[model samples]
Target: MPTTINPLRYPGAKRQLVPYISKLLTNNNLAGSTFIEPYAGSAVVGLELLQKGLIKKLVLVEKDVLIYCFWKCVFYHTEDLCKKIEDTLINVDTWIAMKPLRDIINPNDWDILELGFAGLFFNRTNFSGILRANPIGGIKQASKYKIDCRFNKPILISLIKRLSHLRDKVEINWDDAISFMNKAKKDFIREQCFVYFDPPYFGKGEKLYRHFYLSSDHRVLANFVRQNKHFDWLISYDDDPYICGLYSGIGAKYCPFYLDYTVSSGKRSKGKELLISNLPLPPVDLSMTSSQY
Candidate 1:
């Protein structure tokens, strides 16, 4: 599969796991199955699968309003959205000026495409790509600015062009993950389907992401997935004992996936991730790999 340039810097994106996921699906004869991504953060994995022609159909569901808008624009209005992002200057002054717009804009107003633009701007310029809201409900300013790493026109153009190819084959939605999963299971009963869950990690996600899943929310998700054992499913989470116990007790297969990368603290770190699957996966290899991008 060819590499895709992702403009959005989402936390805990599954770019590194794409190869392993592709291998698993191929070995299991599920390359041409219908693919569902319930918590589509960057929508990177689904896009990759679609680009590689690994999936017959693709469904993406994102709960965050801004992210949903951004993806909607990408799929439906690619050229216009790319032009808007390209023309906008990336500087501290521009970033500061966007604060009020972020504060005033109502996400419910469907006619406004600026929500998508604001999401693109802040996600590209914010520190570590962390989108935090202030106490007053506006976007919080980054503590430090690194002008050299700001968004560039070439990168945005490349990403937009790549996403435009899968517009017809992909369906993007704004809904809760569980709701999408429930509907999808019923809709694709005859066809082979694969569902990949990349929900908010139990502990770390609550602190980093603006919208996060609580422990109770995780439990609810676990129960739902456990009950529905018809579809091929895999969930990604941090390597925490609580999460491991939750899935292991339910008889799901759990394995470790590792990646080495730099963290927000400017230090190199290695993460041991867990993959819980309803079906058995291939043998686990502990070797760490860098992301293809």
Candidate 2:
């Protein structure tokens, strides 16, 4: 497990992949390049790279307004967000109060501060940091772990304050992933940019992600990656035949690798994940991965 810098705990977090990504960046002469993450969730990967000087800057794109507000608050309204974290109660009662934010049909219609605070509160308490899921100890508060298990005020506040200093080094955008890519292609210098796409899971996207892609939506993304293969781009997905075939059809280089995945129940389980990229990536495990050729 790599050092966790961000305050937000995320489901299927790729923070552990930082070492592999860092090595790839160095190997491709992309070190100190401007890194772009289209479907930035917690953005643990990009954050780690920037902090380590592996990337000079980062561009994070997220469509979920609540999530966007969280990043916006972290970057722009640092003291206010830190104060919110400092003075808040992390009991079951407060957790219940925060649950209503999830029911919000259109988060953009709500107050940015309210959504930002609620997102941070819910993410800290929720199992595996899944916004739609229940808190760690469950609603009954019977589990030994309890709701406040992941919310440490001093630690989170410190993390927030530290990250706020890098505001100029990051650009947060509230837009669809592919839409942002289309615009970024012209905006950022292609030679100095490295793009990483961590889209929703293939089979369980609808359940795991609030803004997941439909099959057609996924195809649209694949086509975009295919057309823009000239750019340094990498895409990650849960190991599935359909997802593997989708990129393979577009002549993308792909490989499957094993990683330990922690579930909502707080149990770590090993699973296979796939990475498809336009840039060169040798398979970590030859027996588990098949090339397009």
Candidate 3:
């Protein structure tokens, strides 16, 4: 097994919910199955499964071009990637001090996004490491505040150990998720596959998060889910009227989940997220059971 790989380091990642998610899986009897993440933002949950040996393989699909390429590099060229970052920085001061160099790298380039080699050195030396910039089209702040990532020795060791196992089990896909799942059903006929969908939430301000995922895409995805009769699945999304309407009659066991709104106001809102599962989940009482350790 690989060392503990922290996914919370990524912006907009759901690392804080690892305990809840893992408990959800444990309740569902999902250990050792092939876990599929259609929108694998930062792969926090998927990576956790890998570390715990809870899943046999992680089939990840990310539409974001830069993020997808970055993971590909991590899986294929882990050591070279680390070396490039290391060779670029000597005592970590130069790594964190240079702002011009960080700005120079094009956002389009996967290398820039895969900053673990280059960016991680600087990210680690700062505050909370949120990598936050003002929302697009929003007012430009006088100065940028960063929650710098601390690339400490323990973290480096953990990353290296995990990379070895991750390089082999992680599979990447550039294709549209609906089509990919359709094809996967054919190949993995008898194999158990659990699909996790974390599509974009509606009505969130554009600058609040990445706007790459289009609203129309949800309809297409929901259509695919309604018609496709393949494997068991789980989907998480804002509990909006439109989303509820879409999942209606989809034959999923719907459950409500409260979303932690720590990003914007650092206050928990009355907002809710819906979890739709095609598989039947056991009646595990959250308060009474000590399932989530």
Candidate 4:
């Protein structure tokens, strides 16, 4: 919740692609259009764009109940969330106590908002902000970096408060991306909206993240984006052959680029990623080497 940039830490946070998104929005004359994000994992990109005044409004859709409820608590229960952060102890003992609160298997968003807090706790404390990954410095707590190394309460609360003020410009939804796109096709006017698909990675993504798409669902999403060329849309994924053929075979415009990945050890690694979209990309960026669909 620090940096006025991203309020949440995601293992796959697309902080690097913010520039690319901004350029696309400017070049396509869709600067003020309503931006839609189907997979709201950490919401790194959308919130960055909205906060920077690049987009007029934002719509965040996620099927995961815990993530959705965490966002709900962030925006709707702003004051209480702030107070909770202020009062909570940031230690291994507290981390152990909050484990069951955000179980992806049996996620409970309600129950006095402990689940919501648990979601935030895991996100900030876990390795690389991966919700399901092991706690930072391992459970043994001997890696020099303590559990609360990333949990800056005052800054987190400050960012959350500022973000909550933008509640009027943001809309959060708990639904699959495909369902949201279907409704969007009917409800949106085609010209005023831009959809960004940062679906789970097509390769190790399934194993790396809590929520992911099977092959069939990926195809369904690609089909929708390809068929709806009238609506400016962009999709990205870890560069994989199956994904290449799935979208490129269908004649969608493609741009192969790279986004950077930061491992839990603070080491930076590079990987080639693909950006498939109906809009003309500004240019391929190879920095921060690595999102969607």
How well does candidate 4 score on lDDT at residue 121? 82
Clashing pairs in 1: none
* Alpha-carbon lDDT, every model: 0.74, 0.80, 0.58, 0.78
TM-score of 4: 0.90
Cα error of candidate 2 at position 142, Å: 1.7
Q: What lDDT is reached at residue 141 by model 2?
A: 91
Candidate 2 at residue 160, lDDT? Answer: 85
**Which ranges in model 3 have alpha carbons more than 4 Å from their true place?**
1-4, 7-13, 16-29, 87-157, 208-211, 265-271, 282-293
Q: What TM-scores do the predictions have?
A: 0.88, 0.91, 0.71, 0.90
lDDT of 4: 0.78
Report how far off residue 40 is in candidate 1 (Å): 0.2
Instruction: Say which candidate scores most in TM-score.
Output: 2
Q: What TM value does model 3 have?
A: 0.71
Instruction: List model 3 lDDT by residue over 1-293, tens digit each.
Output: 22236522433335444565667677778778888988765677788777778888999886544445556656776676556545554343453355444443343553543443434443343223323332222232223432222344445545654665676788987655776877777776688777787776665634333334466777888887888777667787777888888778867787775544434453333356677778764432322111000
Worst 10 residues of 2 by lDDT: 284-293
Mind sharing the TM-score for model 2?
0.91
Candidate numbers, best TM-score first, in rank order: 2, 4, 1, 3
- Residue-pair clashes per prediction, in order, are 0, 0, 8, 10
Candidate 4, run of 10 with poorest lDDT: 284-293
